[model samples]
Target chain A: MVEKTPILDTLTYVFLVLGILIVGFPIIYALIAASLPIEDVSKVPMPLIPGDYLLANFTTAWTKGNLGTQLINSFIMASGITIGKISVSLIGAFSIVYFDYRLRKIAFISVFCTLMLPVEVRILPTYEMAANLLGPIQSLVNVMHLNWLIDWFANYDIDISLNLSLLDTYPGLILPLVASATCTFLFRQFFLTIPEELCEAAKMDGASAMTFFRKILLPLSKTNIAALVVIEFVYGWNQYLWPLLITTNPKMMTAVIGLQNIIPQADDLPFWNVAMAGSLIVMLPPVLVVLLMQRWFVKGLVDPEK
Target chain B: MIKRSIFSNPYLPYLLILPQILVTLTFFYWPAFDGLINSMLVSDPFGNYSRFVWFKNFIALFTDFLYLKSIGITLMFSLATAITSMSLGLLIATLANRALKGKAIIRTMLIWPYAVAPAISGILWLFLLHPSYGVVALAIKKFLGVDWNPVLHGGDAMVMVIMASAWKEISYNFVFFIAGMQAIPKSLIEAAAMDGASPFRRFWNITLPLLSPTLFFLMVMNIIYSFFETFGVIHTMTQGGPGGSTNILVYKVYQDGFIGLNLGSSSAQSVVLMSIIIVVTILQFKYVEKKVQYTG
Candidate 1:
């Protein structure tokens, strides 16, 4: 290995600083805008430092925006979707990878193909399907069904109706995201990396499919599960367009929606303090998750070759 | 692992994939069929739920000036974002691949935007360019003495949307490009350099051609993603404003179905969009797959 010249090293540092500033500018700007005082917010030359209105601004946003309720709604919605995506993905991945099947090629291709269609293209039909399923259950009396079999269908409607309304309701925020091809794809790729010999040995030992999956596959793929969990969690947490479409109840909004709704409608925008507070509140979880994923996300992104 | 009878075992895999199949069927295939049927019925996106009047939606879509404009805009947005972001991504990946001091820090910083939700990214940009008292707005007004208001103009808004989309996508491309670069053996580069190939010559001959497979994978994804996912940015930033100037096909699908309550037309749009994507993806696999070199 050859050592770099001092001039080349200095240039690297210079480029790094520029790169950091470019990436960090918006985030820093958001923080500043969220923390500045109301009066100073509209000044021609924006203030460069944190101002005094941080607490009051946050308090106003918290109370008027109903941020607490939204946070809980977001948490519940994200959790439901994450559980659905992960469980469904695991089942699908296990079947495709381990099972000796005739339809393997078709199944694998279909799952891979679905990756080309993102959320928007699929939203229309999914909306209609969701609408047809949830239209009746949205009614108050129908939501009260408590019988076991009926309850399962009832829960589906509850989930569907909540997502359809795009208003203040939990299901409305979560249902659309319950299934994700990306999650499935990631699991499939990871599952492919597991040695097939282990499964063959497990089969010779008479381990059932479920047991082998649980004992061998699940433990082996822990890192992928963790990666997918974090990715899905962040996705569900920061989800905006679908939630924006369905939820009408301001109080039922998720944290992201709450922050968006907090934009002041007055002739002048609100104090930077409140905007900053709202942004900070909505931004934290995803940032923390990204920090967690930095180690694994890179590796996963590159593993298609394997 | 269970090693049941082969015939019996095939069903197990099918059973495993059943949930996905059902969900995909319900959510994707059903709507696709519905859209195909609806596009032929001369109804609005949600209205005219009556008998079949086939090919009417496609006909109308072709004839309508607004629909035509949307097609043009969608192509422009997708193509521009794809080209610009791909090049920028390659450049950034190259820089990061130097693995010089603090390259890891650079990589982390590069990825910061990927963590910021697309919706939030749009909002942040909107705030920065709020035209009156925003940061970028003030900067332009002060430094250039010209007020740049994207809200009022279609052309300006379209350019802004593409730039914002590209900005967010650079991180995506960077991640994949770096990975692709990493997979290339350093020995190849060393061999090229020892043969008296210049740095630029080495990269063009050894680096880029070798990186093509990863580049190709990302290219297909970039096009597909621009078509479908950029709608979120359009929705949050422009809302297809200034008289439908920024309305891409996917956003139009949303508008026709959810906002305009025109399910039939929206379904038609969905069918058309999906068919195009499927065809394009198949072409990639058919033609480009042969060129991908998976060097470990």
Candidate 2:
């Protein structure tokens, strides 16, 4: 806020350069290393500049590691999760904020509690859900003996059995994240700011509640929707622990999981260049999202309550 | 704050709310409930045929040496990450907050790394610090003549993880700190300067006090981040290696629950993490409540 002295100006530049160096060095180094052949990477005093085998390394990582398929899988999972989260949380926000509902406060409070209870804490049972896929629903059907009733329907020449699974699928990857507590909170906050007169005007026009929401609230919520989409998409793309735990098939693996899968976990040394190439690829989408839609990303993160 | 006006829809509101509620109940509440039950019900070493045993898992955790050490290491790691990242963030933020050339460029350069996933960041750092093939590690070896292997040394592993965690977090803290500082009224800063306050004096007197709210907010967020979100980092980098030196509470919960197959103990650890999160969340609400009261 004060007038900067020459010393301070130099210090500021120094700090900027230092910050950039500290932050960007590893990423750049990895990108550089990713380009080189394995022999070049293994040698002491590794090259700091770009290597000549960039295309070859990329192609190798793609063909051998199945990086292309993993990227597609990750895209599907991320977009699926993002859509699921936005839709569920948006309707939730719409319901609680615009409509008068009994136990609304209870619903809100429970959502808040869910914010505190991250999936990491409930990994064991959540893993159970992922493993069994439809265990909860199947058990419900069995407990209530809906199968006997299904047998009763079988007399009408319709067969129904209640066995299902979501293991190694997009729905499995996306379903558990549909209950996005943070997005709900952000949406609720956004909806509260919307002037009540919109709804009043809709009512004056004899608009039904659904129409009122569709025409009024939904349109007004474009910013919140965009912001939450970016945030949730990054979250979905960056999901490591859940997808890592659930997905066993290579065909089902996402890019992030694939990156780690390529890395060495035990005594043997790994293919460093290939691993680095995979990491660089894994980092692309989220970095691009934040860089491209930076305004919404920043606003969504820093000033959500505003 | 209740909405002043709302639609009256008895049926449609419930219909709208049902999807989110059902998802929340199934994924969040049901699993949490299962974890609660599993915590109290002790299972065999092989995790089969568990009978109800209240609080024993928690008791065993307290009595266990490694679990206690994990608590200490987690505290140290969280505090280290938060403080390191936040201080560096504050420093760089202050530097960039000045009327410097290429201000937008500097910020754009600094902020993009926040989008890098924690695990990816860990992998990058691991590549840099790897024993035999790492470029930086080789440079450090030649310059300082110290053997560098995080895979074998606990202290080195902790440092590596803290560095990786702090690296990703610095951009986040930088954003908030810059935003917090920018929100301060320039008139106050100028007034302090006009009153013959030096830049350092003005910063300590006015800017820092004004930034305390943001500081406190980031403190809570960073701590929670280190607890829950650093799973990817630990998983990729150390995997609680070098004899459980870098194992934080969250990772330990995973290590025990998923890898060790001690369902009761892992569930107990989850319950402990639950209480910890509850405390942090309450602290956040308390701060928000105080801010509300202050504003009112």
Candidate 3:
């Protein structure tokens, strides 16, 4: 066994310290800036000491920036999206992994192809289609389609219109993103890792496919499900462009949009304290989710190795 | 084995894939297909496309100097960032791979910033490097004493963008590299050491060559990720600004499609971008893949 050199050990510490500082600086700086009083903020070479205005700053950001409503908007939008995406991905993944059909290869390839295509390119056409096709149908059915039989099953029908003014609306934000490629991919990969013997044994016991998946695979994939939850939550929280496109009303905006709005238009602007406060608020959920699921993230990363 | 009932099974594999199938058709493939169609026609007042104009947008794209320059700039940015990030990642991974104390703590801290979204990372750097009142700005002014502004300066902006992006990216790539390196059997390295090889010599001869397969995979993925996935940073930091010096093709696609209200042109640009990536990917698989051995 070879012992480490003193020089190497010192170098490692130095490298680690420097790397940690560089990485942690933003959040650290944000915390300090957000906690500082307005008077202290004016000091040149801004004071490094923690100030006592944290509550005041939080109150200001909440009311002045309307972050309360923004938080609600973001939660509703993200939750709707999460539910829709999970549902679609579960169904899609099950089909891709379990079903034996012709065009399965094409389905897989098309999904892979979607992974490479930037969402920006399709924004325009999607907007037009959502407005014309989905909007109209939804509205048309909402009135006449909501009937006595409908009272038994589900709540509403699709809206029918060519209008796209529903940008900030929940349906507007949620409808276009009902499916996710990454989730599907993850599910497929996880499903493939499960031995077929369990499925065969279940089949021999007279279990249906749906029953097998629900009772067997679902329970076995607790880790994957946890990983997917954290991943989906983080993604939904940090999403920027699509939400920005679909939502124009300030009341319906997310924390991300709130962060953007808080940025000042002038030089020597953005009022670092306020911006930092807002950024911290917006970043809190994702960071917390990651921290809680830190083990899951590590496992997710390593599982690919196996 | 061909069960006749399987063909008419109500819930077919294709049906399982139907939601995503519809999503892809309506969103990705259909729009791309529509773009190809629209490229041939002019947009009318009623939103109706006119008669065909074959190869017009593609030809126009070639003639446009700015578009061509953007394509070139994107390639440069992707290449520079990928190489810089991968090299830094390898170095960090190698360092982390040593029998070092607090390595787990170091790994956690090193990867913390990667949890920060790309948009936030750009903003953090922008604030830190702001010409006035920024921590780094004041230090540079007091020490170097030259007017150091990242905004209005092209070279500085590019360097800042690259540094910010590369710093963020290295952590991600390093995670993969570290994992890859850890997977390598320690006995191989010890066996090489028994042959009178110095640590440095062993690293060069044994460690690096063995890590090449993972490195190659990283190289391909990192390059592609940089090419398409860097729009968030560009959009937030420079918005391809300081006289369009930082506008990569993907950023240009965002600008053209959303900002400029020119869907046809944006689609044309995306098609070109797709072609470049596809070709590069194919070349990597066809040529470079044969040279490496993935033990896993």
DockQ values of all predictions = 0.43, 0.66, 0.35
Error of 3 at A65 (Å): 2.7
Candidates in descending lDDT order: 2, 1, 3
Interface RMSD of 1: 3.7
CAPRI docking class of candidate 3: acceptable
Off by over 4 Å in 1: A1-4, A100-113, A134-175, A265-273, B1-15, B44-49, B142-146, B292-296
Top candidate (DockQ): 2
Q: Give the number of the best model, judged by lDDT.
A: 2
Model 3 ranges with Cα > 4 A deviation? A38-44, A79-83, A134-166, A267-270, B1-15, B44-51, B141-146, B280-291, B294-296
By TM-score, the best candidate is 2
Clashes of each: 23, 0, 14
- Model 1, B35-87: lDDT tens per residue? 67656665543353456767777777788888888999999989998988888
User: After superposition, which runs of candidate 2 have C-alpha atoms over 4 Å from their true positions?
Assistant: A133-163, A264-270, B45-48, B142-145, B288-296
Whole-model lDDT, candidate 3? 0.70
DockQ-derived CAPRI band for the predicted complex in model 2:
medium
Ten contiguous residues minimizing lDDT sum, candidate 3 chain A: A157-166
